[model samples]
Target: MYRYDEFDETIVRERVKQFRGQVARRLSGELTEEQFKPLRLMNGLYLQLHAYMLRVAIPYGVLSSRQLRRLAHVARRYDKGYGHFTTRQNIQYNWPALVDVPDILDALADVEMHAIQTSGNCIRNVTSDQYAGAAADEVEDPRPWCEIIRQWSTFHPEFSYLPRKFKIAVTASPHDRAAVKVHDIGLILKKGEGGKTGFEVIVGGGLGRTPYIGHTIRDFLPKEHILSYLEAIMRVYNLNGRRDNLFKSRIKILVNTEGPENFRDQVEAEWEKIRDCDIDIPREEIERIKRYFAPPAFEALPGESASFEAARARDAGFDRWVRVNVVAHKVPGYAIANVSLKEPGRPPGDATAEQMEAVADLGERFSFDEIRVTHEQNLCLPHVRKDDLYAVYQALKEAGLAAANVGLASDIIACPGLDYCDLANARSIPIAQALAERFAASGEEEDLGELKINISGCINACGHHHIGHIGILGVDKKGEEFYQITLGGSGAEDASLGEIAGRGLSSSEVVDAVERLARFYKRERREGERFLDAYRRLGHDAFKGAIYADA
Candidate 1:
């Protein structure tokens, strides 16, 4: 994990001091709601439907155990005993008092964490692969580069106020766990000419009212030139992206209106002007950042752990959990354990203060005192020993964090819809809860295999419903809550927006509708086909026919 330096410490302390005064002004009526909107947003505070929500950034999803413990403290002391981990690899405190926000920020600053850039029209938190350093398939850890971008973008005067919020993501794995294709800027690290590291850059990818899988603007951009290239892209978007309509302001809309080729050309022309300037990070600084993410020391152990195998043989529950929640590590005898936050009957990403503390302790004991937040709304112990898998599972089980439903039908991604957000048209958490319960009750989650069901309160797509294998978007229908389903969506390497299946289903019908889709897939899928593959082969009509056959 990246540690804060003297400069980092100074800036955070100064920001906290400055925001303390700003917040005091707002509470004292010296600043009206309109006057304080941008100021509060810049500090990651939002006036939600019922209360103020504070979003704190967990950069590139990495956290030290100490940091996690601090977050747990904040939840226990300030909010309502829980925090919501978000799809952007951030966490939200939903019930912080207006006057107490500065105190909360000060608490966060103590642990080298803050809410800066977590919200606002400026560049948001830079996210990356949860399994970055530990993944067996990775070209290299992407977190260093993510850190580089974070350093470059934070408080950047040029991109301080874009037409819309900008998001960037990076991945070093070919498996695409970061969902790079759906970001405003996506970078895939790859071995370029002479086996040197470089990036394949994608631009204008986003999901909101309009969704798009980004265009590959640069087939290969040297790692050394990443900052300059990103600057070029930002310059292009800032100059030409629409400012007239709120709905049409995103870079994706600009890319669509001007076409990818023209957008790429514009970026290239801009890059030609500044690529050689002093904007790119120095080689020494890059190497310095890289040192922070160096892999933790590992004992030379056999690839397979006999104790782990014995535990799996002894316990069916342990075996099932290992099958679903554990992934292979790049290091022998180690594993990346995903902690599923989507327990049946719970809000998808809500982690109780105790659960957070439990996970922090588990990470401290097993994973080099580090925890990772996945873009899919899960926490990860990115470097646990395979031999310790059972112990970790037992601890998680005790904390109610071990659901063993990763990539299963029960592992849902849902936003805090009308439950929190004033922008939401309908509630999303209940739908997610109902679906998870339905799947768990049926005991078909394991059988379904690698199903992603994402629910969004509204079309802002905060839940990333556009990329789920089965997407449920809440819509208001004559004072009734309805869900519009979409099929064949994926956020993987084969990223694509889902097609709307058919008419909206009422709250009661939506869960059954999802069940129908799953059962239909089970019946209709060809041998060896997953839900997504089957959907692609069968198309939207088949799923639509099954769901709406009785509508």
Candidate 2:
């Protein structure tokens, strides 16, 4: 994790002070709600349907045990006893008082964390593969680059107050776990011709009302030129991106209007002028950042632990959890474990203060004091020893975090919909819960196999429903909740947006519709075919028949 320097500390402290005064003025009626809106948003505060919501950034989804503990403390002391982990790998407290926001920011600053850029139109938290440093297949860790971008974009005078929110994701692995293709800017780190690590830059990818997979703008950009290239892209967007309409304000809209090829040419032209400018990341600086993410010390040991094998043989639940939660690590004896937040019938990506505290303790005890939040909205103990897997599983199970549902049909990704979000027109959580229960009751999940079902309450696609093997989008129809289903979308290396099957189903009919679709896939799939593969092979016609046969 990148530690905050004095400069970083000072800036955050000053910003907190400024926000405190702004809040005071707003409450005092000196500033109207319209005047206070942008300021509050800039600080990661939002006025929800009922109360204010504060989203705190957990940079690159990396947190120290201390920071995790502090977050638990905040959850307990400030608002409700729980917080929601978002798709962007940030945490949101749904009920924070406007008057106490400065205090909340102060508490976050104490742990070297803040809500800065977690919201607003400027660059939000730069995210990456949660398994960046530990993944065996990675060419390089992507966190350092994410950190570099975070630093450059934070309070950037030139790029602040963009037409809309900007997102950037980086991944060093051949597999696109960070969903880079769907970001405003995506960087895939790869080995260049001379075996030098660099970035494959993709620009203008986003999902909202209009979704797009980013177009590759630069096949290869040397690591040192990353910041400079990013600046060039931002400069182009700032100068040329539409400001006339909020719906057409995103860079994706601009890219679509100009065509990707022309947009690429424009970015290249801008890059040529700014390639060696002040933001040109120096080699020394990059090295300095990289050092922070170097792998932790590990003792070499046998790949398979005798004790773990014994536990698996003895405990069926533990065995199931181990199968789904544990991931292969680069280190011989260590494994990365995902602590699932999507337990059956619960809000997805939500952790109570007690569960958060338990995870912090486990991270300290078993994961070398480090915790990671996956883009999939799960907590990770990134460097747990294989021998300790059973013990960690037991602890997690006790805390209700040991659900063996990672990447399964029941492990749904859903946003805080109309229940919490002002922009949402429908409720997403209840639908997710209903579907999860339906799948669990049917015992049909095993048949489904490696299915991803993501739900977003609106077209913002915050829940990443656009890429699910089965995607569900909630919409408002005359004050009633309705859901639209899409099939065959994927967020991996071969990324594709899902196509809607047919008419939107009412909330009551969605789970049954999904079940029907799953049943259809089971009957129609070739041997060993996954849902996505089957969907792609058979096309929407098969699923459409299943969903609308009785409609």
Candidate 3:
């Protein structure tokens, strides 16, 4: 984790002081709601239906045990005793008092975390794969580049007021766990002829009202020129991106209007002028950042652990958990363990203050003081020793964080729909809860391997509904809330948007509809085929007929 320096501390303190004054003015009636809207939004405060919600950025989803404890403290003291982790790799506090938000931001700054750039038209959080430095398949760690981009995009005057918000994600693995294809800018770390690192710079991918898989603009850009190349892309979008309609203001729209070739040509022309300018990142700075992410002291041990296997053999619960929640680590004796937040009947990403504190404790004791938040709304202990698997499972089970559903149907991804969001039409949490319970009771989730079911209350796609294996979108028709189902969507290396199945189902019909699709896939699937693979092979009609049988 990158600790804040003197400069970082000073700037965050100054930003908090300025916002404190702005908030005081709003509360004292010196400024109206409309007047204070932009100012509050700039600081990651939103006026939702019931109360103000504060979103705090967790950069690239990496957290030290110390930072995680501070977040737990914030959750306990300031607002409700819980926080909701969002899809963008940030956490949201739903009921913070408007007057208490400044103090919350101050509390966050004390831990070198903040709400800055978590919300706004400028570049949002620079996300990467959770298993960045630890993944076996990584060509290079992508966090240094993400951090570099973070430092560059923070308060850059040129992009401070873009037509729409922009997002950038970096992934070093061939697996594309970061969903780079669906970001405004996506960078894949790759090695060239001399094993020198560079980026496959992708541009224009996004999901909202209109969805797109970002196009690769530069096949290979030198590592040193990342900042300059990004500046060129931002400059091009800022100059020509639409300002008239808020709906079409994103860079994706601009890239679509002008074909990828023309977009690439324009960016290349801009890059030629600035590629070797003073803005280019120096090699020393890159090296300096890289040092912060170097591997921790990993002891050499055998790949097969006798104690670990013996413990799993004794306990059925632990054995099932190990099968679903544990993954192979780059290091021989260590394993990557996922702490599932999707316990049946709870909101998918909600972690109580006590649970957060427990997780921090687990990370410190068993995982080399490091924790990561997964894009699937789970917490990961990235470097847990294989020998301590049973003890870690026991700790998690006691804390109510030990569900064994990682990629199963029960491990659902859902947004705060009508329950918390004013923009929502139907309720997503209930639909997700209903489906998870339905699957759990039938014991069918384990059989339906690697199914991703994502739900969004509205078309804004905050839940990433566009990329789920089974995507559920909440729609309002004749003032009634209905759920639409889509199949064949995936957010992997072969990224593809889901297609709508048929007519939207009523709220009461949602769970039954999802179960029908599951049954259809199970009947049609070949050996070891995932729901996505089978959906692609069988096509949408096979599942669509199951759900729309009455229609």
TM-score for each model: 0.99, 0.98, 0.99
- TM-score for candidate 1, residues paired by index: 0.99
Model 2 misplaced stretches (Cα beyond 4 Å): none
Predictions in order: lDDT: 0.93, 0.90, 0.91
Residues 1-551, candidate 3: write the lDDT tens digits. 67777988997889899999999999999999999999988888999999999999999999989899999998999878999998878999999998998999899889898898888788999999989888889998888888889889888999989999999999999999899999999999998878887999989998888999989998888888999999999999999999999999999999999999999999999999988789977889888888888888999999989999999999999999999999889999889999999998999999999999999999999998999998889999999999988889999999999999998998999999999999998899999888888888888778788999999999998888899999999999999999999888888889999998888989888788888888888888899999899988887788889887654
- What lDDT is reached at residue 421 by model 3? 99
Cα lDDT of model 1 by residue, 1-551, tens digit = 89989988888889899999999898899999999999999989999989999999999999999999999999999999999999999999999998999999999999989999888888999999999999999998899999999989989999989998999999999999999999999999999889988999999899898999999999999899999999999999998889999999999999989999999999999999999899998999999999998889888989998999999999999999999999999999999999999999999999999999999999999999999999999999999999999999999999999999998999899999998899898899999999999998998788889999999989998888899999999999888888999988999999999999878989999998899899999999887899999999988888889897665
Candidate 1 ranges beyond 4 A from true positions = none
Give the distance in Å from residue 468's predicted Cα in candidate 1 to where it truly belongs.
1.1
Q: Please provide the root mean square deviation of candidate 1 (C-alpha atoms, Å).
A: 0.9
Model 1, residue pairs in steric clash:
none
- lDDT by residue (236-260, candidate 2, tens digit) is 8999999999989999998889999
Q: After the best TM-score superposition of candidate 3, give how far the Cα of residue 235 lies from its true spot, in angstroms.
A: 0.4
